[model samples]
Target: MSHTATPPPAMPPKLAEIVDEFASAPRDVVLEMLLEYSDAVPPLPETMTDRAGMEQVPECQTAFFLRVEVAADRTVTTWFDCPPEAPTTRAFAGILAEGLTGAGADQVLAVPDDLYQRMGLAQAISPLRVRGGTAILARLKRQVREQIG
Candidate 1:
């Protein structure tokens, strides 16, 4: 007798609610939901800047690097994880550019809780976190490219 493989469990309903909302929603709707989810997911680093100038940056500031492994039924699971970090104007822009071009993400964003919490908005973040986010983003981008290719 032949046996079929059983699939993994789907994402939790609560988490699915959040991910599906973003996955299927319009850009503005996704952004709004992401903000709400980010807020509730704290002890988040509130130290990130509140400056309106930061808005000039692209949407990539909020995207977390992920390796999404989709099942036959289209359920998604992360095959790999990278910590949240996006620091510096130049590095942030590069992340958006590379992530978009490489990952096919029209927009890329990040959650810099670790960096922001450590640096706080008043005090500048340590050079380490700043550099770390850049490095991690670069590494994740490369990984995505290699896998896709």
Candidate 2:
């Protein structure tokens, strides 16, 4: 018998592009791209300097906090706090921040929960790190739902 793998659900355009890139990239290139994204993680705005309002994702091996804001128009913006030492976690945050920010709440919520799996990150990074990324997506989506309600 022969079987075919099912494609992942459609994602937001930017995120889908990122996933497609990683899915086809060599392992070394994946790591390099992740590092590039790590550097791309945006700085927290002045109002979020305290980070008291952010939620922590204990699933991450490092200390990581994130906040998701949905504008009155239902556009989403994400902020993340992770030590520079934790490049992988920072890369995950950067991916979400860049891909999901400016997306509609419905679009953000429609994102598949197994986003990291689709990116093929486990082939380049540890499963634990991939798990952390998954948790980050979950938290971001939860916040989006809360904001919309």
Candidate 3:
């Protein structure tokens, strides 16, 4: 019998590109790209600086918090808080924040839950770390759903 591998679900364009990029990159390049993304995670907005309203992702080894807002037009904006010492977790936040922000809620909702797996991060980072990234995406998506409702 012959079987075909299932394709990943459709994702926001920017996120899809990031996943494709990491999927093809070498292990060293993946780690390098992750560090670059770590620097790309924008600082929380002035309103969110206190992080009082943010939800924590307990799966992360480091302290990580996030919030998602969906505009009337359904554009999604994400905020992530992660320590500079945890580059891997911050990179995951950067990827989601940069890629999902400005995207439509439907597009953001369409993103696969196992996005880190598609990004091939398990090859470059520890499985535990990868799980944190997965949890981040899950929480981000849940917040988006809550906002849109």
Candidate 4:
């Protein structure tokens, strides 16, 4: 079946391009991209290396944690912690971190809630995993709102 992906919401140019890239790739290709992203997630900064600053996402079956920092100019920096065994969950973190990191708080907040659906991962990953991915984004946006407002 053919799927139509919605346009990305206002965001950084790089982030919007990443979303579009996933949306345009084949389902199997999307899965490959996810794996590639998982490897690309960067090490947490010294300030967040202590785990105390990171919030765990209980919605994911895996023990996933993340933190987002906003600069005076509203640019964002995100960090994620996840096990090697939980590549799928970690991929969500990597994708978010790679895609949205350095975006303005307003841009991150404007991202579409269903952006993950456009990745075409539903055919490869479980619904629960997909929900977890969405939850991660929701949490990111929540933290951004709380910090900047």
Q: What are the models' TM-scores?
A: 0.28, 0.90, 0.91, 0.88
Tell me the tens digit of each residue's lDDT in model 3 across 59-96. Answer: 99999999888889988888889999998899998888
By summed lDDT, the worst window of 10 consecutive residues in model 2 runs over 6-15
For model 1 the local lDDT of residue 112 reads 26
* lDDT (10s digit) by residue, model 2, range 1-149: 88898764345789888888988987778899988899878988898888969999999999999998899898888889999999999999888878875688888887888888888888888999999999999999999898888
TM-score for candidate 1, please give it: 0.28
| Residue ranges of candidate 2 with Cα displaced over 4 Å | 1-10
**Quick one: best TM-score, which candidate?**
3
Record all residue pairs in model 1 with backbone atoms less than 3 Å apart, i.e. clashing: 47-121, 60-108, 60-109, 61-109, 61-110, 62-109, 62-110, 63-109, 63-110
Per-residue lDDT, model 1, residue 108, is 20
Query: What digit string (tens of lDDT, one per residue) describes model 4 on residues 15-120?
Result: 7788888888877677888888888678876766778788898999998888888889998888889988988998888888878867899889988888788767
Candidate 4 displacement at residue 129 in angstroms: 0.4
lDDT (10s digit) by residue, model 1, range 1-149:
99898754332334333334444555445334333332222121233323311112122344433333333443322222222342243333332232233222111222222322222211333455445445444453344334444
Q: How many angstroms is residue 61 displaced in model 4 relative to the true structure, after the best TM-score fit?
A: 1.0
